[model samples]
Target chain A: MDSEYKKEDFLLLFGSRIDIIRRKKGYSYERIAQGCNIDGSDISKISKGRVNITLSSILELSKGLDIHPKELFDFEIEA
Target chain B: MDSEYKKEDFLLLFGSRIDIIRRKKGYSYERIAQGCNIDGSDISKISKGRVNITLSSILELSKGLDIHPKELFDFEIEA
Candidate 1:
């Protein structure tokens, strides 16, 4: 599209948001992994924007963090 | 996890939300398709919760809808 942001940028921002939330909650990747199928190492990769996480992953992450999935996407994106 | 809702439910809810937004905007799937890689048919599948869309697809859908990606996930998910 004509937008300035690319898919990669969006993924990076999403990952950063996850990192921020987990850190704020004092939850390690292992802690988050306890509630989901993803490995703690995979969570780390996802937090680093290394994974193209799916909708299922989103649910897993939210369940892991015990928060609404929408919270993960609660970050700014210029219109 | 022990939550009542499953990943499938989340996908269904998310798809419903997209349908709500697109309809509210008076946008057809074809119209949304014009701005992203997803086809109108795929959008139809997604709206029906038949597709487990990826993060990139989320970005494409947001671009297609001309809204923040977060808006796509703006739905209530019970704890």
Candidate 2:
């Protein structure tokens, strides 16, 4: 289904999906942040839909999770 | 190999990949932007490595390109 998303909806869905992926990989936000060398607070914000997550951020997050970057997009994300 | 990237290298690679995808889809920057309801100038800038492209932006771009978001990460991106 082609769903139109506002930036807010998009961010919310992205955060939820990232949260799911982090949990599935058995990583705490702090651990993943450490792996990514990003701030833990920033990771928490990203997971809570409080920031505009960049492509580089996704790549770093996937790297931290030890998964293909594409795997991050492999789910249905609800707004 | 785990490629540790600077933000600049990351942006360049992301732009290159986006350009490759846009071309593979036979889309001009204008048309895809139209489809995504985004600014054409911004799309052009994105392809030029001038933006810190967001996850939501990628989703909209994939929608515009009529491809899976995962497809955007299908190739190896060089710095």
User: Tens digit of lDDT per residue, candidate 2, span B1-79?
Assistant: 1647566766777678889988887899888877786688998888788888887788888777777777777766442
Model 1, A1-79: lDDT tens per residue? 3465788888898999999999999999999998888899999999999899999999899888888888899988876
TM-score of each: 0.94, 0.80
Query: Could you give the CAPRI-style class of model 1?
Result: medium
Q: Write the per-residue lDDT of candidate 1 for residues B1-79, one digit (tens) a residue.
A: 3455788888898899999999999999999999888999999999989899999999899888998777888888765
Residue-wise C-alpha lDDT for candidate 2, range A1-79, written one tens digit per residue: 2647566866777678888988887888888877786678888898888888787787788767767677667766442
- Candidate 2 clashes between residue pairs 3 or more apart in a chain or in different chains: none
TM-score of 1: 0.94
Flag regions of model 1 displaced more than 4 Å: A1-4, B1-4
Give the poorly placed runs of model 2, Cα more than 4 Å off: A1-3, A77-79, B1-3, B77-79
Error of 1 at A9 (Å): 1.1
Q: What is the lDDT for B61 in model 2?
A: 80
Looking at model 2 chain A, report the run of 10 residues with the lowest lDDT sum.
Answer: A70-79
